[model samples]
Target: MASRRAAGRIVRGLGYTSAAAAVGGGVLYLSYRPRDIPGSEAAAVPPPTYGEGGIFRPPSFPNVKTRAEQIADLKRSSGTVSGAVEKAQSGITSLLKGDANDVQESNQGGKDEPYDLLVIGGGATGTGIALDAATRGLRVAMVDRDDFASGTSSKSTKLVHGGVRYLEKAVFELDYNQYKLVKEALRERRYFLDTAPHLSSWLPIMIPVDKWWKAPYFWAGTKAYDFLAGSENIESSYFLTKSKALDAFPMLKKSGLVGALVYYDGAHNDSRMNVSLAMTAALYGATIVNHVEITGLEKDADGRLI
Candidate 1:
């Protein structure tokens, strides 16, 4: 797999958002026709919140700021970020233990130490968090109730594809935020194949086009999907003849098959990847522990998590 250059491109600036989904089979990357919504047709809605429901919330201090706002704030506070990792390292220390509640208070680096990050759950999301923080030189610790990737992470279909359905919805609803999400996912899909080649492989998926006319239609969609991926794309998509499609998969019924759209995605061992992330984090000085269920949380006087 070729490494994609980090040629900075400005995708649609939305609110700060992170999405996770169970890896699945090839998405139906059908081309979507963007619909233009008139200015009068837009709905009048309040800003969204980051936390659960809260009534009588103030407009100035919004519970959740959009991605645009978050980026803007980062730019404004750019000077304050120097030595951030060092500070986090000083604040947090060895926080991992077999028992979730077992905090070695007498130890030099114990529960009393100020942690930079406390990642709950040991699935892909949690381990990814721990790895990212540890790599940044932050004091990070992760705890999972059970074994890592024992949940949906291990149960994934294991194909890493851009969410074509989300793209379809974005185009239909004229939601630029959704468009940004699709672009992000596509980029990450490429990253997985590029970084962890040992654990991941390219999977050629065939979209059987039952009707002759539909071949061009589906092919166009996949082309757009490939284009969105840009340098991250694994390989260019191409059409296969009916006989060629049947040859690729002998189980297909030959009667109505007109052609197929063949595209490249990624397949991997989801559980192993999750474990690898945790191990990598541990190697980077993060404390990773499992079978530690967090029954409750502790907070300080300021209502901040301890």
Candidate 2:
């Protein structure tokens, strides 16, 4: 009975001790608790604690001025920049739009009428001129007995290049138009290759030189041709031994041939090139018609050839 009484007392003691410890912890918490303020608020309200002090405010600009105030401040501080923003916007638009009528539609009325440009011969020269005029915001019409490049242009040496023979002749020799044409042709060649790579590509040519002096001279001129190009699309000019040259081109006469200068230029089936260029021009807002003839040169009231 006595042992049972002792066990009961021990259980009661443990319960009392636990209750006392809990009450003591509660008292400590109450002692250090935040005291209620009598409405003494901070004038500089600390911003709410955002994560890591980085906040995502919804772009609400406070102390934001009205349009009048902003304008007055701008006039006072920076002043007007003339047409700064307008000019900038125009420049950006021009750059982005890529030429004035880049995205414009063509006047198909030329096809409805007799013609716009009466390209007499449908050779490269005429077709080229027609394409140039037509793409540059003019109406164009072409006529031939058959398809384009069916004349002298069709039978040329078939190179869209700086005529190397003329270059050699010009020891005091170079035509300004020819040089300009070479440079322009190189750029145009790039455009053609870019726009229609399958049809237009760089081609290597073999120029047979009979003498050592002629070989170096020919090589130099071709190098200059390649140099004039902003970028070389084909392999640079190199000397080929008689055997190598003959292997490449067996049709040349074996007599008087010392070595040959093999260089690159652009070549094409001129007829196909014309068709492709015409299609590209049409895509870029040029109206083109083939095989249609004009009875007479139409003139405006001012006597300007219409």
Candidate 3:
């Protein structure tokens, strides 16, 4: 126990030393640099490149309105919220191709016009699948019984951390699948934060440890979680002394408090994100419709899902 406490003290001292050295180095480097060099002048911005720096002419969506125009129209629309929603919906619906404006039109287009992928839900999973299919140049269509994200997608607790609980289970149970789930989730967590800064952000969380003996275990596990994320890891996990943790979050229970594990995950607007996913898929030529019910499934002679 004495040795363990001494090791902890050494680690904390080294951390403080490292932080001070970083600050000193930064200050010295800045002091010695050319004062006249404007930050922007230090780097030349590269010219924007489109289509492999003049490869064979890229395909264009002829007769398609610019996204700016659609957004402008929505912003300029007036009247009730219902009217605005209808107008916005119409704007999105107009982007569909090959008689995708109506389900009846799709039927008229015949068996030849069947979608490559017909996703049956409008939540995160369905919209994500539609987006993936559409981007790969497949004919994609999605339908929902109600508004997008009206179901479980909208019921998220808004914490986008890796399934640390799953990771814990994996560690104890020696389950590889659970570890893979954590890794996959961490990758997605990074992608979500990077791809949609408007709807998502890095959120710091505190896992309070109640006993001195438990702090090392919590720290090791969290550090392993950070390592599993590789480049996608948001922020490294670290120990926070009891006073510091209390300073960060005063409402934390004081009794039996030893320290806390501080780490980052993501927080997001689930509903807005779901809508964006579907709209983005629509922009990529997928047909997305809501308020459409599928009461039964159709099957062929082989009993394939259709």
| Candidate achieving the largest lDDT | 3
Report how far off residue 121 is in candidate 2 (Å). Answer: 4.4
lDDT tens digits, residue span 124-226, model 1: 9999988777655565557788999999999999977787667777878999999999999888887887688778776777799999889878787778877
Candidates' TM-scores? 0.63, 0.55, 0.64
Tens-digit lDDT track of model 2 for 1-306: 999999999999999999999987764453335543322444323455555458645432213233353233322321111333443354345436665343223322222332234456666777677666555544444455566666676687666665565544544555666666666767777676566555655677778988878976877887777677756454566677777678878987889888788677777677787766655444443344454454565456666454
The residue-level lDDT of candidate 1 at 167 comes to: 75
Our model 1 lands, by Cα RMSD against the true structure, at: 23.1
**TM accuracy, model 3:** 0.64
- Candidate 2 weakest ten by summed lDDT: 73-82
- Relative to the unseen true structure, what is the C-alpha lDDT of residue 72 in candidate 1, on a scale of 0 to 100? 40
Better of 1 and 2 by TM-score: 1
Better of 1 and 2 by lDDT: 1
- Candidate 3: regions farther than 4 A off: 1-112, 298-306
Task: Give candidate 2 misplaced runs (Cα > 4 Å).
Answer: 1-106, 109-121, 143-145, 169-171, 174-178, 250-257, 284-287, 298-301, 304-306
TM-score of 1: 0.63
> What's the candidate order when arranged by decreasing lDDT?
3, 1, 2
Q: How high is the CA lDDT of each candidate model?
A: 0.66, 0.57, 0.70
